[model samples]
Target: MGGIVPMRDAGRTGTLPATSDELSRLLTVVRRGRVLTVTGRFREPRSRLVREIARRLSSNFCDGAAVVAIGRPFGVRELTAALGCVPGMPFLPYGTADAVSWLAERDMLLVLDGAEHLAPEALAWLRRLLTAAPGLRILASGRSPLAFEGERVHRL
Candidate 1:
């Protein structure tokens, strides 16, 4: 699938093209055997959206791949559980390097949510994860790019 595009509000006239097709194509490529990072502002009540994408990823990639969300106060445990993966502790305490290494080894999705505050750290983690885990893909939700090399960013 392509990157997740935010639905346009009714009657909105001007905005960036949603590039849903491109995002899907990229997703397909990544699903085959690559890493992807999705960065943008995610809307609240994200369960349904998360579940749908996770379901597709699970179906296509098997259970090895997981969507790991990093942020505060978002009920990530429940969300990951709903997606049928054991929810690990939030990527705090452990430094960015350690967190990335741990998650990469697991071959999980590694979703980084509400990461504006942790952008620098998250970028470092993403770079390491991309290098360390060939099977891992990241779907980050934030207000800006991680600015890593080869990062295919799709804005929301």
Candidate 2:
């Protein structure tokens, strides 16, 4: 709702981004319309990178940002709530569409931590989210890439 995500934990130091070159590249891509997926076997690298990126860019960007850690098995509804976009009505409880509608046209960065364990169905729904939210930028951390169209998968 504000300049920075209210959920950002400034204290936590997870796995950091690879280097300045990669970090700079990632930042540049997210600023544009590109979806950057920071791939890794563990969640720490992706989580740490998101935190560092947020801390650095929160001072500059007027857009919004939210990071959610999906450490284990979770479904569509849990995924939406995990991202802090709880469905307001009974018609769309835990629906990815609800989350996209909640996002509307706002420019924001969403970090999905521990995405490796997401079910195939959940991953498909996530692709829908990407398509629905044009201004939405995702930085996903997973053992394997989501493999959605236009997804820029960077293995760590």
Candidate 3:
């Protein structure tokens, strides 16, 4: 709760607290779905909300997590390590297939920040990951939708 930083929208005439009860309710909705994408024109503020949600979920037995930025490909290995998984268990996965397999059966929260710039194809792994790991939940933020089937898109 404390880690969340409110956003200043200079684009508008007034600034608003980016993190609000509305965002909390949004998190509740996101929690209900296996996959969720938070979209907004204000990328920074939206991403801040996503990060806050992830922070709230971090202590809920999350095994892996990352705020994947634009221009960055898959970095699930670093997330896995952040979750306390041993580094280089066998090999680092650079692709989604291997990343999914690497995260098989793990109950984790993976955050994808700046998702709008991410190629839609890059998220093909989400469907499989959701199906394979029942305990996994993805929280993404971007201007556009991830377009994954069953993905709940919340726009701010």
- The regions of model 2 sitting more than 4 angstroms off are 1-17, 58-63, 85-96
Arrange candidates by TM-score, descending. Answer: 2, 3, 1
Between candidates 1 and 2, the lDDT winner: 2
Superposed model 1: Cα runs more than 4 Å off:
1-23, 32-42, 45-51, 62-65, 71-85, 88-104
What's the TM-score of every candidate structure?
A: 0.53, 0.76, 0.69
Worst 10 residues of 2 by lDDT: 85-94
As for TM-score, the candidate ahead, 2 or 3, is: 2
For residues 12-124, could you state the per-residue lDDT of candidate 1 as single tens digits? 33332335675466557456544344455554323223333444465453323344444443332333332333333343323444544555555555454444445344455
How does model 2 fare in lDDT?
0.64
| Candidate 2 TM-score, C-alpha based | 0.76
lDDT digits (tens) for residues 62-117 of candidate 3? 55344444434443443333323222234435655666776676666667676655
Task: Superpose all Cα atoms of candidate 3 onto the true structure and report the RMSD in Å to 1 decimal.
Answer: 6.9
Model 2, range 13-126, lDDT digits (tens) per residue? Answer: 544657889888877766764466777766566667766765565544335556666666877767766665422222334566666786655566676666776778778877
Compare the candidates by lDDT and give the number of the best one.
Answer: 2
